[model samples]
Target: MLAFGCTWLYDGAMSRSDRFEIFLAAPPGLEEVLTDEAREMGFGPVTAVPGGAGLTGQWTDVWRANLELRGAGRVLARIGSFRALHLAQLDKRARKFDWAAYLRPDVPLRIEATCRKSKIYHAGAATERIARAITETLGAPIAEDATLRLMARIEDDLVTFSLDTSGEPLHRRGYKEAVGKAPMRETLGALFLRQCGYDGAEPVLDPMCGSGTFVIEAAEIAVGLPPGRARRFAFEDLAGFDAEAWQAMQTPRPPRDTPLRFYGSDRDAGAVRMAGANAARAGVAALTKFTCQSVSALTRPEGAPGLVMVNPPYGARIGNRKLLFGLYAALGEVLRREMRGWRVGLVTSDGGLARATGLPFLPPGPPVAHGGLKVTLWRTGPL
Candidate 1:
């Protein structure tokens, strides 16, 4: 056991220079996909972890992470790491951390802790201890409902702490005021696009476009829109954040008006309406066409071949799964008959439904954990 003392105190100062290790959390199977995206955005020494990736860089790199990197759910900057055998040790080391650099008395914050295979078996007690230390020592208040959340994890006597820079999950891109039943997340949609080899130059289609997630995300990618353009991030509230630099980073660009670059169709009129509303909010309504039509009614645009991405319903709820199998079959028939030579990416949690497609199955990449279910992302063609 470690003794608790007032020797650990923070004066709320900023260091002139520091480098941070960011652990980006992703959906189960998209670690490699996110690691590649981090590398493309200039993050170095990227490595894939179980649920995410790790990268090392400076504060500017953190800013760029908020600007770019669409595949991540949240970017967590590791603030402190040390070995702690019990609650006393955990509290002592957490107090010694330089919390004053990132937190302020005026800015509200909260801590979430998880313990595994360590002497500190109770997660709630560990979280309370650390929260009390920051509050009592650093003069930072403990907010019960703070948007900026810090995560603490203790495994094998090693404690690691991180601040979540992205407030909510990055998938809530702010344009989606409404959502369809069993809707896909925008971050997962972008990763599926990359899996299908979508480069934003080719046309994209979503036969079962729900709330226009895949279609709108594709249009935004094609037009070079930043994923985080519409919302505020937690980093904006940090101590050393440069408001002027952030404002300059928000330079508005004109919308792309390319015809048929994106197309979407849904059998439900309500879904089509919601999709159009979402597209209008995203400033890409002109570039996308959402129609109330079934998969059989889907037609190719007057242009070169593009990719078709679909997240068809699996029978997850009562009375829906059985009916959706036929729907998936119909979708496969339509794609096979009408969409030959166009690539296809389908996301579903049911293997039986995927086998029913009758289309030649290219083995799925990896299973992604979505909505508490393991879903496979299947891809076929360039045909």
Candidate 2:
């Protein structure tokens, strides 16, 4: 039991349809993509928000979101929502909303507040006001640095508060001990895999598999491995986290032993080693086979024609564009020579480099933000 202001509440046992609200955050322009992912993972009535989506479901739904949603960066539990016209109104409402139900007094917590198009225009002052209110009303000490964070967003006079169920970003799957100079996030890798229509049935190859993200994500998807299986989530420390239920949801059974359907090769041997280690941590090393080879040395695996996806180094970070044009030309030559009839997806920040591949791609769609750079996923082969 915990007490906040005059309202004290006990931790109630959760039911199957307890109506837990989840707020899913994503990169810009990925709200709809994440919403669709939530619905596919059994979340109902998913509604899109500014930087995320909201859905109503149970703890199991939360588990599913954490495990399966590919485009989401973080999933938060909506604790409360209201409209606040002033600091007093916000403080009074916050005191009455039963924060004790979600947080423990002994556990250190931090408050993060954002104000936009509201009466409270000063974000820093507003944050301080709310923090003081919570501390004074609830008698809970506010630590400057706390692992448990309560996020508050004020949009058009409406205040939405949520608990970050994912402390670290969900993409840090605790696999890649070493990352390349420019590495793709694990969530983006998974989403791109889904966008490319990779079902794990055929051979999947990433010719320029830096840090092996695409290849590892493909192996996980192919083997039905849950993306969060290798990581610890913030929800694990919440009041009513069910460890047993979470453990039971781990992949259910061993990966189905398919042939060498996942393959990755890179010109950098160090990247190859890192990829192998990441694959091993993901428990998909058996499904994936990595080699220290260049794009020119690419070979098609012995299986049904499948996806050939690559996130070649763009000039934005590593590799000079002038030098990469030759590399892209070599890749184009290799793809034309070896990988006919195989679907191809390329992620690049530069249109010229993508065009250099000469794969007859569909017109590039709107850019998606990746690592502070605007990038697009260009697809070719059979629409």
Clashing pairs in 1: 315-321, 341-383
Off by over 4 Å in 2: 1-17, 47-50
Q: After superposition, how far is residue 80 of candidate 2 from its true place, in Å?
A: 1.0
Model 1 misses residue 83 by how many Å? 3.1
Give per-model TM-scores: 0.92, 0.90
lDDT of each: 0.81, 0.76
Q: Model 1 over residues 1-383: C-alpha lDDT tens digits?
A: 01011122233333636555777888878988988888876787888887788876666777678777788888887666677888888788777777777887678888888888898889999989999888877787788789888888777777777788888889998899988888899999998888788868888899989899999999998887888888889988877778898787777776655555689989889999999999999888888999999888877777788898988888873247778778778888888888878989888888888878876779888888888888898888765
Candidate with top lDDT is 1
Which predicted model would earn the best TM-score? 1
For model 1, the superposed segments whose C-alpha errors exceed 4 Å read: 1-16, 253-260, 317-319
Residue-pair clashes, model 1: 2
Give a tens-digit lDDT track for model 2, residues 1-383: 00011121223423435676677887666667677777777777887776777777666777778777767788777666677888888777776666666666667788888887899777787778777767776666678687778888887787777787777788888788878878999888777777777766777889988788998888777777777767777677666567897887864677776665688998889999998998888788878888998788887677678888888888986768899998888888888888878888899999999998777897766688898899888998742
